[model samples]
Each structure stands twice: as structure tokens, then as C-alpha cells.
Target: MSIVAVLNTKGGVGKTTTALNLAVGRALQGRNVLAVDADRQGSLLAALSNRGEREPCIAVAQYVEGQALRQQVLRAAALYDDIVIDAGGRDNTALRAALLLADKVIIPFLPRSFDIWSLDDMSALLVEARAIKHVDAYALLTMSDARGTDNEAAGQAVPDDMQLLPTTVGRRKAFADAGGAGLSVLELPAHRDSKAMAETQALLAAIFN
Candidate 1:
């Protein structure tokens, strides 16, 4: 079993969205996935509650911090094939605790100046996390422009300690719409944007394969 934590020290970096989609996408792939919301905002829970009834089922849990969070994740490790933790937007006890157990950590950032700058903070946090335990980390560019040098520039800015995923998700309306409805691009109806689905699928493949 693999424990994956979707984390970024900065807010609005698509941490929750990535976590939600990752959990649902894995479930759709027939994996026994459990999504753990370690964020106090509860965005993951809110999204899952609105998920379509026909979509693949994904078990979920919430734990903010302290011993309980660590204990529960350990207990869940025996039951789920994969555990996806949605950590808060900042460095805290929860995030630190998650790092201790996560086998992999996905850090999503936009192709922007602020988001690029946040990578340093994340790198440092990961350094601290690694001091305690070994955890593989990756940087994923999100909300990238369809055609621009921004994506390339941002990809190059990723910290050396973190591997950058080749698949980049564009700034597509389909993501926002699907997120609002608590659904993934893969679960969108017949008119779903092909690019969105393709990007999401590519992301899952890059991470899970």
C-alpha cells in the first residue's frame, strides 16, 4: 500500500483539487482508495459529499492533527490499497505528521510568480520531512496556459529535490465546473472536454504508473 499526500505550503495551489481527483481517479482504476482530509477547511469532504452517485466509491476520513491523525493513517494502511491525504495549505503539525507516513508527496503549483516562489518553501519543508523519513516528492504544474512559455519556465523552476511531472494540466473551465459539482473530469458527461479528461488521465498515469 502507498500513502500519498497532496501538499503545498501555499494556498490556492490546487492541493485539494489534486487530492480529490487523485483519490477518485484511483478508485475508478479499481484501487481501494481512501481519501484523508487533514485540512481544517474540509474542502475535500465537501467535494466528496457532492460527488455523483454513479461514480466509483471512495472511502474518506478527516483528521486535523496530533496522535489521532498518525494512528488512524497507520490503521488505514492495513485496509486500503492507497491512501491520499489532503494536507492544509501551510506547514503545520498535520502536514509534518503526514510527511512522516507518506510514501509520496505531490506538490501542485500554478505557472505564476508567486506559485514558483513557493517551491523554495516547499523544498525546505520536504527537507525537514526527509530528515525524519524518506518520501518521494514531485512537482506538478497546474492551471497552465494552453500555449505559452510560462509552463516551460515554471517547470524549470521546480526544486531539484522534487521531480517535475511531464504532464501539465491546463487552465480549463472543465476543471472548475467539475470541481464545483464534486466530480472529476473523467466523470463529466458526454460533452466533457476531451483535453481535460486527457490531462487528468495523463496525470494519474504519470503518478501511479
Candidate 2:
């Protein structure tokens, strides 16, 4: 089994959005995927509940403390083919706990100066994480402007110590719409092959391949 954590030290960088979409996308591909919500905000699980969706199709579990989080993730690894964690947007215990268990970590950042600035802080965290575990980490631009070159510029600014993913998710209404309906951009009836879906698929491929 493979375990991945979707994280960023800064909030509102689309951590939950990335976690949910990745979980659903993998499940659609016939994987036994389990999404773990390690955030106290419970944003990951809330997204599905708010839209009245439930599983067997996509299993979810919430555990916030470091000990419990690590224990649960380790146990679930034996049963699920894939595990995706939505870590809290802070350098807190939950995030640390996840880093200990994850095989790879995906950090999402918005394409703004302030967001790019936070990458320094996130870099420090990743450094500490890598020192203790053999975890592969990458940063992906999320909620990027579709019309401007800001995303490209931001990608260049990312620290060389941190890996930056080529695939980026633009600021599209389809993301919010699909999240509201408790579906992934790929799971949406129409726009199944739209830019949003393509971006999501690219991220999944980058992470899983």
C-alpha cells in the first residue's frame, strides 16, 4: 500500500480539495482508497458530508492527535491499496504525525507572492521531515490564474530543495462546483474531460506513477 499526505503550512492552499480529489480519482481507477482527515477543522470529511455522499465507494477516517493519527494510518495501510491524508495547515502535531507515516507528501500552494513566501517555512518543515523519514515531497501550484503567467513565474520561485510539480490546478468554478456535489472534477457528469479534470488527472499521475 502507498500513503500520501496533502499538506501546506499555510492555510487555504487547497489541501482538502487536493486530498478529496486525489482520493476520488484513485478510487475511480479501482483502487481501495481511504482518505484520512487529520485536520481539526475536519474540512476533508466535511466536504463529503455537506454534499450528502458516503462510502464503500470512498472510505474516510478522522484522527487528529499524533499518536492516534500515526497508529490509524499504519493500521489502515495494511487494508487499503492507497491512503490519502489531509493534514492541518500548520506545523502542528497532526502534520508531523502524517509526515512520519506518509511515503510521499504533496504540498499545494497558491500562485501569489505571500503563498510563495510560505514555501520557505514549508521547506524547513520538509527538511525536518526528510531527516527522520525517507519521504518524497513535491509542491504543486493550486488555484492558479488561468489567464496569466503567474503560475509559471511562481513555479520558478520555488526553492530548488523542494520539488515542484509541472501540473497545476487553475482557479476554475468547476472545482468548487464538484466539491459542493461531493464529487471529483473527473467524477462530474459534464466537463468530465475539461481543464479541471485534466489538471486533476495530471496531479494523480504525477503522484502515483
Candidate 3:
């Protein structure tokens, strides 16, 4: 089984969104997925709770404490094909615990100054995480402008240790709209934005393939 953690030390970086979508996307591909909400806010839990009945079902659990999070993930590892953890927006015990067990880490950041600055702390955390175990980590640019050099600049700014994903998710209404309704871009209806679906699919392919 693969355990993936979507994390960032800054808020509003789309960690929860990435986790949610990745879980649902994998489930759609016939993999049993467990999505863990390690954030105190419980947004991931709430989102999965409200998902449409017709959408692919993703098992979810909320564990905020460090040891609880780690223990639960280990016990459930064999039950599910994939586990996606939303590790909140800070460097805390829960986040640290996730780093200890996750096989892959996906860090999402907006193409902006504050987000770029936060990567320094994330790099240090990854350094600490690596000392104990090996984790494949990748940086992704989210909410990127469709027309600008910001994406390129932000990609260049990513720490050398963390490879930047080639696929960038643009700032789109489809994500917000689908998310509000507890749905992924891939699950949206006839009027859904094709670009949004395409971007999300590309992201999943980059990570899982």
C-alpha cells in the first residue's frame, strides 16, 4: 500500500483539496482509498462526509494527535490500497507523525511570495523526515495564473530536494464549485470545466503513474 501525505506549512495552499481529490481520483481508478484528516479544522472530514452518493466512495478518518495519527495509519495500511493524509497548515506533531510514515509527500503552494517563502520551513521539515526514512516528495503549483510567468518563477523557486511537478492546477471556478458540493472535478456533470478535469487527471497521473 502507498501512504501519501499532502502537506504545507502555510494555510490556503490547497493541501486538503489535493488530499481529497487524490483520494477520490484513486478510488475512481478502483483502488480502495482512506483519507485521513490530521488538521484540527476537520475540513477534509466535512468534505468527504458530504460527497455525493453517486461519487466514488473514499473511506475517511480524523486523527489529530501525533501518536493516534501514526498508529491509525499503520493499522489501516493493509485494509486500504492507498492512504491520503491532509496534514494541516503548520509544522506540528500530527504533520511530523505523517512524515514519518508517508511514502510520498505532495506539497502544494500558490505561485506567490508568501507561499514561496514557506517552502524554507518545509524543506527543513523534510530534511528531518528524511533522517528517519526515505520519502519521495514533490512540489506542485496550485491556483496558478493561466497567463503569466509566475508559474515558471515559482517552479524555479522550489527547493532542489523536492522535485516540482510538471502539471500545475490553475485558479479555476470548477475546483471551488465542485469542492463546495463535495465533488471532484472528475465527478462534475455535463457543464463541468474540461480544463479543470484535465488538470486534476494530469495531477493524479503524475503522482500515481
Q: What is the C-alpha RMSD of each candidate to the true structure, in Å?
A: 1.3, 1.6, 1.0
**Local accuracy of candidate 1 as per-residue lDDT tens digits, 111-145:** 99999999999899888878888889999999888
RMSD of 1: 1.3
Per-model tally of clashing residue pairs: 0, 0, 0
Task: Give a tens-digit lDDT track for model 3, residues 1-209.
Answer: 89999989899998888888899899999999999999999989998888847557878899999999999999999999999999958889999999888988999999999999988888999899899889788999999998879889999999988999999898888888777766788898756798889999999999998
TM-score of 2: 0.94
For model 3, the stretches where C-alpha displacement exceeds 4 angstroms are none
Give the alpha-carbon lDDT of every model. 0.88, 0.86, 0.90
What's each prediction's TM-score?
0.95, 0.94, 0.97
Minimal lDDT window, size 10, model 2: 48-57
Q: What is the lDDT of residue 41 in candidate 3?
A: 97
Clashes of 1: 0
Best by TM-score: 3
Give the candidates in order of TM-score, highest first.
3, 1, 2
Better of 1 and 3 by TM-score: 3
Two-way TM-score contest, 2 vs 3, winner: 3
